[model samples]
Target chain A: MVDVPQLVEQARQGRPRAVARLISLVEGAAPELREVMATLAPLTGGAYVVGLTGSPGVGKSTTTSALVTAYRKVGKRVGVLAVDPSSPFSGGALLGDRVRMSEHASDPGVYIRSMATRGHLGGLAWAAPQAIRVLDAAGCDVILVETVGVGQSEVEIASQADTSVVLLAPGMGDGIQAAKAGILEIGDVYVVNKADRDGADATARELNHMLGLGESRAPGDWRPPIVKTVAARGEGIDEVVEALEKHRAWMEERGVLARRRLARAAREVETIAVTALRSRIGDLSGDRHLDALAERIVAGDTDPYRAADELVEGLTNGA
Target chain B: MVDVPQLVEQARQGRPRAVARLISLVEGAAPELREVMATLAPLTGGAYVVGLTGSPGVGKSTTTSALVTAYRKVGKRVGVLAVDPSSPFSGGALLGDRVRMSEHASDPGVYIRSMATRGHLGGLAWAAPQAIRVLDAAGCDVILVETVGVGQSEVEIASQADTSVVLLAPGMGDGIQAAKAGILEIGDVYVVNKADRDGADATARELNHMLGLGESRAPGDWRPPIVKTVAARGEGIDEVVEALEKHRAWMEERGVLARRRLARAAREVETIAVTALRSRIGDLSGDRHLDALAERIVAGDTDPYRAADELVEGLTNGA
Candidate 1:
């Protein structure tokens, strides 16, 4: 049996393996997850979470590695959680991404882990926050949560952060694509990565134009700033970091950071509650109550809404 | 106010505008949806739902159009629900896809509607089945559900169909990509579209090899068959239709069709139930009960699971 208290102590001392184990428990929905979270809760609320998200091939991993280097140079312990919600089969693509971030793999002050949702019920919604908590309790000064692709789940994950960084690359159809993916609204700091490539200036210009088109901010409102960087060559990364810090400061001054964290906590709680309820509903199917309702619906004797009402009634009545 | 009975009557008589209006109501989650669904419950179960899905640039739209023509040739009334889950902006790309399908716009026997989730809470899960119900009640003998992109939502939407058709194109990196996207396990019919292109045979061979590597089927189990086609020119569509029919026959023979329908109905009911519960949970946040819990969690006084447990307990006790 795993020693939960011992594991928590090891993680708090910055033992990477214990942190990984806690995250794995969260990913697997292991029975001991509740205890782990309870033990870690008091130690969390310390790490500053910055979520980086963009389309594939947009240099997210490289930028993440660069950010790790930048943060470590300042003597801050950093944690990286690379989340892949797209792939169901875990570890393959995650391993490749970890390899790309291998320079930091051997650094004792840096903790890096790759997580795949593996077709979990809530995908990253249920897993990422807990993993972030683990990192936060592991004495990390900063945690970078990076997602692989631009999808609804990825956007949702990015929005959970205190500061969300949306990345784009030149000639990638990213300006309008970002809007369509709903990332434009969620970005606190936007990065035009691969800034040395052709049309870099145009991409940044178009992005600025697009971002300005729907502006309704007051004079003192926090406007999201765009940073240009060549993440591969580690060029302009410090500027990107500065933009992030400025955004963080703005959020802190406005009390937006506390509000965002509270909202994130609310969402995490709601997701867990819903997932628990769903598992109970799944149990109803095993007992043929749901099956009976389904048969009635399929036979046209009833509709799904009425059937759903019955299920909810049973659930709320402690069935 | 709309007349639900009259509208359902018009749809039963196959009036295209009535069908469109009913679908609009479903998409909008109109308050009268329960009444409409109750009225249409007995009228459904006639359409054979075939879901076509693949990555972008895999000729999904072309293959879907060709399949419509093939089914129409046999005098089958068809309904097409082109779902774009990836695009939150909606309408622009959906309109483009509709123009691609304009050749059937004037045909009274054909009903084509493009639906976008618009970032709805349950997304396509909540909308697609209800839309499918509308099309089925409108007297479509065959209904086609085509989703844009290869993502988790698209896979889910495809799986809701009676027979899921997974499309692929040569040189699309689709052989292994299929397995990674979790589409291989959900496909009831496989189509390699753009067959005239280079590496078509290699794609097919590689897909076959991958499909065979995980074989654990019994003697009478239905093996998913791969059909090659150049959908733009309408080549090999008849064979695709034949494969679909054979699979449908196999399912009916084993009573799998009825069972699949029952399972689908069960899922629909469960989603509706969960969505209703989620809305109630949302209400809790508005009243600050959830906010209090969230504050406690953020303050490290409690973990999310414990907070969620309290929330669920209140909900079950008629909170």
Candidate 2:
């Protein structure tokens, strides 16, 4: 058995392998995860998490890499969690992005890991926060979470971050698409990537117009800022970082940062609790208690509500 | 307050308004949901649920309409639940599809309702099953659950059905797309709709090849049949229906139907229990108990697991 304290100590000392192993424990739901989490708990809360989400071809990975470079320039320790919710196979969708991110592979100050949903019950909802915890405890000053696709999981992961960045490219009809994906509300910083492409100005204007359309914000409320960039060439990346810092400062000034972190922590706790309860329910199925209840429900002898109530009662009382 | 029993009774008599009201209650999570579900429980288990799912532009609504007509011609009362998981606003995305289903709207024997997720915590996972229960108890012979999009929720809804029909259209790269969507395993029957179009045969061939690639089924295993259909003209629908019946018969012969229903009921009960527990957790937030725990977690005084354990313990014991 791996020593949880030793592993966590190594991770906290900027050992990438230890950090990766801890995240592996999180992803695989390893037996030592609870111990690992406890060991790292007091060491966390230093990393600022920024979530980047967009449709494929919006240059999420490029932007993420560029952000890493910018953060590293300030001598800040960085971590990247490239989450691909669509791929059942971990690392498959991120293979090319991994190659692009090789520039930071040799940098001990940078830690990067790719995660997929892997058909987990809650998908990223349960896993991402734990993975983020791993990075935060590993002494990373800033963590960038870049997720592909605009699906429900992406929206969910975005909201869990300390700051959310919604990325879009020109000529993709992304302004309306962003609204449709429900990311517009979660995004604190929006990047119009591929700014060198045609329709860049048009897209930015349209996004600005739409972002303004639905509103009643107080004078002091933080309005999400839009930044334009050609992430491929690292152009306008500093401005992107600037925008992120400004948003972070604004959140801190208004006490939103602490509130967001508290909310995020609550959600994380809830997810873990729910997952544990679900597994207990799964155990009931293995013992045929759930099966028997389900059989009665199928037989119309009891309603699902009543059967569920009994099940919940048994669980609560039995525990 | 509306009388739950009266509404359920009217619903049982095949009153469309009563059916719609019950579904609305399910969507809104009305206070009388438990009573309504109890009254409807004995009346359910009769409707054979057929879940049809695919990407947009695949003529799902058209095929569903055709199926409704076919079922009605055989003197079978039909219910159609057009679920749009992508749409946050209820019935917004399905408005056009509802208009197309107007023919059945005039027929009292047929009940059609468009349901969007409405941003519920579990989205369709919590609502769809309840709505299906409502439809099943309303004396429908078969309930067609047509959901748009190939997201996780769609895959989930498809698996919940007694028989899942995955729709694909020619020239849409649908065969590969279907496999990528993870619907390949959930489908009991696959329909290559718009069979009159070019590449229909190719799509079917590719789909067949892909379906066979990773399988080593026993002799008696039910192989999902792929049916070609021009649903707009109602062509090849009978064969689709026949395929469905054959699959159903196969499932029944092997007792798979009972097992599937039992498993589905188990899931439904679990979802309800989990949702209830989640609300209790939400209540903890209002009481600032969860906030205190979250604050501890954010302050790095405790890990999420231990905090979650305390929260769960409080919930179980307090209840």
Candidate 3:
């Protein structure tokens, strides 16, 4: 209603409000958002998209804040999407993070946005990537995506980010929880946040031991680095950023980044195609003939493939 | 490799081996399996399907076994599909349940099969429904689906079955885990399994209290009944079966079965359509032109939807 395409264009030219509005449109899964993305596509891929994920109470926000401050010190424009899927308990915590990052509010060089997952599974699948697009288009050199660390949603970060950083808290039961959950395979860098806490070293050691147990499927010589961070006190933030840059460089050198990007694009296209096909087939519901075919399929008088063939034939040949 | 149509035909005539083969083929998601199901679809709807699910360690297997035994007592043949998804630590726990149901192996009237969910999320998605179809075609009067107690997969059970029974183990925390997780909304029959345990009464009280909080969304006079059961001792099995029967009758009287079966048929057809689209898109990887489009999308020069449009155009009209 607010000239969404015009806002997307303005956002492409580096307007903050326009960027915010564009992100909201994408997050809402607006039908026309894809058209705008097509227009803005060439301006992306420059930003270093780093995803930070871990279980709740792992200090991801503090570590992210420290990283933002560190990146800013080096004269880099930074964008942060601190993703918290809305829970009453986490809502208050996210508000605290908003207040914590307000120091950068006056700084044009550092832009921080909090995106709530809003019950979207796999950490706001469409919104997370689109937010990166906005931040990248707005000329941010680095975009940090801090995702809420629910078990299943965490994996989506691996799909969406250029580099994924998995955080773990100290004395949070067995480090085995992190290792056995397929989280070990997803991280491009692992961070033991709250390193000042007791048993932090032990957790890091456990993670390293577990990481060594699995074979890497990633096409690179780069093994994910484990960085310890006491984010509240701004300790070890530089090292994490350094490790990320190193991984990015290594991936580029090995051509892994380009290959990964291609795979991601192919997957996205397939998702779109599938969505289209599903919708088209969903249209069959309104037709009585199609309904009879469905009943026949359900009744076992005909197989689904034959029914599908008939449906497609009807669509193609105007049956 | 088997003559699937002949097997399907034999399955319709109540041959156990034929039924087992047909179910395996369908569960395998093999292309040929669709023909078998299409042919057998008219033969379905004879069995009343029951789904049992809850949090892990809730004694679902024991409860399911008891239900099977009870159904068998009434001279009704029963089929069970005990689905266990593979976890990182184990290949699958399906074999364990199969061993548990081994006591019923000698009984020709009772057929039990255990399935691994493989990579499918929400355990009940593919294999569970296929098993139900095969059993239905095999002339089983009752089909029971047992799911490993992950909350997300349990939601699928409600829509998949004629009557859904959510089993809650007594003294497993506050019973809030199942309630807060939305498992309570899905069950048509709530069973306090392991009712001999301490806090059994409290668990029943909590379930009743939660049930009272919701105005029934289920049609007609069919409110889900809460039955207490010590499945290990076979206590309260009769009441559980009675509740299942009453719910089944309620479903039939209100034409809910036809509606549900209708919905399932539509969903199955849609899934096949989506799968076909996936294969079509996957096959397009032979061309490098699509590769260029992907880079633009990742680079932020293109949005996914328009890129998809481009794909369609490229495939259909010479672009």
Off by over 4 Å in 1: A1-3, A85-100, A213-217, B85-100, B176-178, B213-218
> DockQ of each model against the real complex?
0.74, 0.75, 0.48
The order by descending lDDT is 1, 2, 3
TM-score attained by chain A of model 3 = 0.83
Clash count for candidate 1 is 0
- Expressed as tens digits, the lDDT of each residue in B1-319 for candidate 1 is 9899999999989899999999988878899889989998999999999998887668787788888899999899999888854321134446655576778878899998888646666778888899999999999999999886456776788998999998899997886767756787788888999999999999988888877834778987999999999987999999999999999999999999999999899999999999989998998888999999999999999999999999999888889
Interface RMSD of each: 1.1, 1.2, 3.4
Return the TM-score for each candidate structure: 0.93, 0.93, 0.84
Q: Is the docking of candidate 2 incorrect, acceptable, medium or high quality?
A: medium
2 or 3, greater by lDDT: 2
Winner by TM-score: 2
lDDT of each: 0.86, 0.84, 0.71
Give the Å error, residue A240, model 2: 1.1
DockQ metric, candidate 2: 0.75
- What value does DockQ give for candidate 1? 0.74
Ten residues in sequence with the least summed lDDT for candidate 2 chain B: B84-93
Question: Please, what are the lDDT tens digits per residue for candidate 2 over residues A1-319?
Answer: 9899989989888888999999999888889988988887888889899999887678887888889999999999998888854321235546766677787988999998878654776678888888999999898999998876556776788878999998999998787667756777777888999999999999888888888834678888888888999987999999999999999899899999999999999888988888888887887778898999998999988988899898888778763
